[model samples]
Target: MHRSVTAGAAAAALLALSACSSSGSSGSSGSSSPAASASASSAVTGTVTVFAAASLKNTFTQIGKMFEDAHPGTKVVFNFGGSDTLAASIVNGAPADVFASASLATMRTVTDKGDAAGTPTVFVGNGLEIAVQPGNPLHITELQGLANPSVKVVLCAKTVPCGAAAQTALAAGNVTVTPVSYEQDVTATLTEVGLGEADAGLVYQTDVKGAAGKVDGVNFPEAACAINKYPIVTLAHPSR
Candidate 1:
């Protein structure tokens, strides 16, 4: 959700699926928006199970509902989790119709396994930020501030894209941070800051935005080096 688009048009374009012919191999990999638009116009019926990154929970949920509203009989179910975990599940034979990852590294796991019908597409981009308690508590203004021993910071595990981005940003600033906890996903990292259990957490900008009054976000220049590109792909074998 880095670059917002009209919900209807964006949803259609993002989930644009090539029409599946009698031969299962006939479906296009959806390499471009025009192709997706063309396929979206066709009446698509049946349920689609989407495995997506944890960061896309709110946006994708809205898109799923809109897609269902537009296509009455087409159901959109979702499995939201850390991108790496979701990718591993798909590569391990989990039945999912779509795979949307927060980073290209995770998407490669699926494409490299030949689980995707075609190449994955970059739909959106996001950047990392520091999530702190409201009222500017601890007054964290930059990446190096989190390195303070008293900051009580939290971060996503290295296995996740957010964690990877955090590391890159920290490296860019030449800062070393030791978090109080390592979360499995972005939401969990945000939760620590929201509940005041931790003074700050490294999460995506969208996550901080969603937190509203529960937390405040601090933007640092180092985050520019850690911007993440989201990728989505249609799975080769879907279980309906």
Candidate 2:
């Protein structure tokens, strides 16, 4: 659904501050005091809409809630979907304030259009895994296992980051899979397996963790070949 990221340190504090202002200048923070907290809270008091990757749904939801709590009267709304789709939406004037993409290439779609407030920074990294039913009913093991003709695998569309990563991992392992279906996003791919619609699907580790009991994750060595770095940036729009 999305594409690239760089050093992780760049976005350490972006989560809390990106939605606060339009300034590109940096400032040092003082000791956390009541006055400082009050000043931060009063800096911004409107809704900040974030368009993010579906894989970020769980993590971003938590962050959004914390943001809302830290600044009373301020709201943080999120639109989570495949990174590629989100990027396309933003480029077409989706009216979002922030964009946290799972892929660097996906973020480039927006940045290249001059739609970003600043450089997009890597906030985190995610790797792929095989999501299957609660137990190993078919005894599927590694990337090679997905090659079985009867596996009934589901995959994300190659245009999306997760799907692209899955393809990389499969290539690294020299394994081939004929998916039963191609989903638009990783969430949809994982849901297919979670609902027992497919035997397995390649998805981000975070996705499996998010689905928990609904699906079980199978780690494979090839996943290291396609780890995706997540990037966060404030979109250049009328809101800021």
Q: What are the Cα lDDT values of the candidates?
A: 0.77, 0.77
lDDT by residue (tens digit), candidate 2, 16-109: 5433321211121213346534444444555677888998788677777877676565666778999999999999987777788888899999
53-139: candidate 1 lDDT, tens digit per residue? 888787777777777787766677889999999999988999877888989999999999899876777767788889999987688
The number of residue pairs in model 2 that clash at the backbone is 12
- The ten-residue window of minimal lDDT in model 2 covers 1-10
